[model samples]
Target: MNSRFDPSPAAVPPRGQLLLVSICLALYLLFCLQQIVLPFRFFGMTLSLGSVTMLGCMLAISAGSLVRHGVPSELVRPLLAILMCIAALSASVLASNHIGLACAFAVRYATSLLALWAMLSLAAACPRWPRAATLAALIAVWFNLALAGAVWFQWPGALRVALAFHPEETFKYLPRISGMYEHPALLATSAAMVLLLVLRLQQRGEVGRISLALALVGAVLALALTQVRNTLLPVGVLMAWWAWPRSCTSNRQRHIARVALGGIAVLAVFVLWLRYPDMTSAAQENMMTAFTLGRTYLWSGALDAWREHPWFGLGAGVFQFMVPDYTGGRFHRGELHAHNLLLAALSETGLFGLLAGLALIFALWRPLLRIAAERQWAIAWLILVLGLSTFDFYFPFFPFSMHAALAVASLHAGHCAPSQADGVSRSTT
Candidate 1:
């Protein structure tokens, strides 16, 4: 019936507010370019333009938030401080390389995590901007889908080559499109994230039913073209969970049943693995196989690194250096990350970082549950975040992670009152 687009930001905000909205929108557009790697010298250090813009926005928003709204009552600041302290400690004490490398790693770690918190705080400051955030996320989705559609229909190689980190490998597969990201899996993940944002907007009545249906169709088509299975499993689960009948069931019972269902699914997979060992071989050959594909070596090396430094683990972004020692140069070669979020946390920052991460998740959990209880479609976005991170490491990829953070910020502030999302009793400004 009616379009769900909110024009309040344009209609109500004063000149300064309008400027802030325009700046945010422009930054999101740059971030959505996903393929572009415009690097320049910034204070003697090389950095991507997109990353610098995002970081600057985060710092500015956080500073303005502190000034207008006072400090957030949420655990964002203290958790951030703890993470930085641990990163500094790990860099100095447990790093396996030169001091400079350790310092660089720590800086990267802080910047990445801080970007996430910055989005959260920005949402807290501007509670009415979830519609804007959703629009930005949708733009990213459309950009990715258009590029992927072109690649699937035998588009010229020159166009595809521009979007990939490795131009030589861009055309290795006939119809498998990588969209604007480095890998097909990354494109799939980013697209799935965009779909989640769309679904969230629909839940808040910010998207029409017909538009939602068409968006879902387009997103799934793009995901299939990417040929990435990691993105499929979670999206499938989200659909099933969203469509699951909830009548006559108590909340506690539903929670228990969900846990049981998860366990059953895991066991069923294990049984299938034992029954058909040949599937393992097939899995190794295909990169889409979730468990196989020589990831054990990666996981093993990660565990070994964790055992070496149990508390803080190896240092931030040091998984590559330590994993090689355990992989014997077999599977770890040229692999920059642990490929799994929890493993990356364990291997890089160890238990301390993992705990901090959990704390951060817990901070977001309350609002998430509140929203999910009211709107089942809302859970999919959070599931998309966990699902991608579980199967692949997107935390260090600033473009993807920044978009994810935007979705989370929108969700965190979407259903709750302004005071509730900020975890404050009253608005200060």
Candidate 2:
């Protein structure tokens, strides 16, 4: 396999390929900054310029792939899985009480799949695509961190600019800084993912020691400012896992220690839950309630909705609307989602949709495993992203889902050849 950091002349991408990769990377950076960019409503869905541009780029890439070479054999399973997921979501839409909302969600899901396909195709076309993407992600994350700092320090005109680009009205009421994103949790998760990528690149000798140190410090600052405990918890765990010295202990000992620690953590959490009332002075101020932001109530409501429609679900995007009905208006207005990916999936698509989702993950198992072997930190980044989704919506959201797809495609591209690898007998580009 040709490594992006390979010093051989043949490993270097050609000038044209470099230019193309740079352009795509630039567009991706814009996509990362979508929240701050001006947006327009299209059929009741808000569309950012960055998203439209990226979509156009993806369409162009897809078209070029069709004309140059047919779909790669390696992608057959993944494409089928995506189609199955879309079909399941469409079925849920049919069962939804709010047809328009469900349809919109279904369309977004389709778009996300298209973006994934385009990324994989691009990776096949450009061997250096993954390296370029890593650099772009790092730069974009640092830029957002800088913006967050500006907002924090009350820089001139920063607040005004942030307000103008802010999508949610409730943002003005909150003290947390979201930077260019719709929510602080989103920014925090994105930062964590990028930080992991940076660490991986450094481990592979693609980044310098100074760069790695700077990234670590910047990531810590950003996480502190975001104050998102969900993201913070996973990040803390990952950092500790990575920082632990491995030379002193055998692999078996390490594994045993990790297992023991995990058991202890679970037991502690159970005890806390059991004695939460006695531990807190008031119900509203309890650690569980504060940590979850009262999401336990919302989760219960979602479970109620799921119980009512255990099979097909309420539909692709009906959960938010039905929140008031299920929660008795306790979580009405600006709540937007179930705030948890699995709960949202269960409440909106039910068992059928959940099964389709699982199938999609299973289909990508090979690529994910390949990534784990070649770039372990990428898998860690993926895990962190999923962990964040447990506390907030990431999969159902636009750009965030696209971001994950890009990472997977880039990593898969790095490990496989454009042709002859993974059963591809012909050029996929």
Best by TM-score: 2
- The C-alpha stretches of model 2 lying farther than 4 A from their native spots are 1-25, 32-43, 163-165, 168-170, 239-287, 370-372, 375-382, 421-429
Candidate 2, residues 37-144, lDDT tens digits: the string is 444575476766656666777788778865665556666677678878888888888887777788877776777877887777767767567666766666666777
Error of 1 at 288 (Å): 12
Model 2, global lDDT: 0.67
Lowest summed lDDT across 10 adjacent residues in model 2 is found at 1-10
Model 1 Cα lDDT, one tens digit per residue, 124-179 = 66766755665555555666667666666756874744454333455564456765
Model 1: how far residue 95 lies from native, Å: 3.8
TM-score of each: 0.74, 0.79
Q: What is the C-alpha RMSD of each candidate to the true structure, in Å?
A: 6.8, 6.1
Candidate lDDT scores, in order, read: 0.61, 0.67
- Model 1 clashing residue pairs (backbone): none
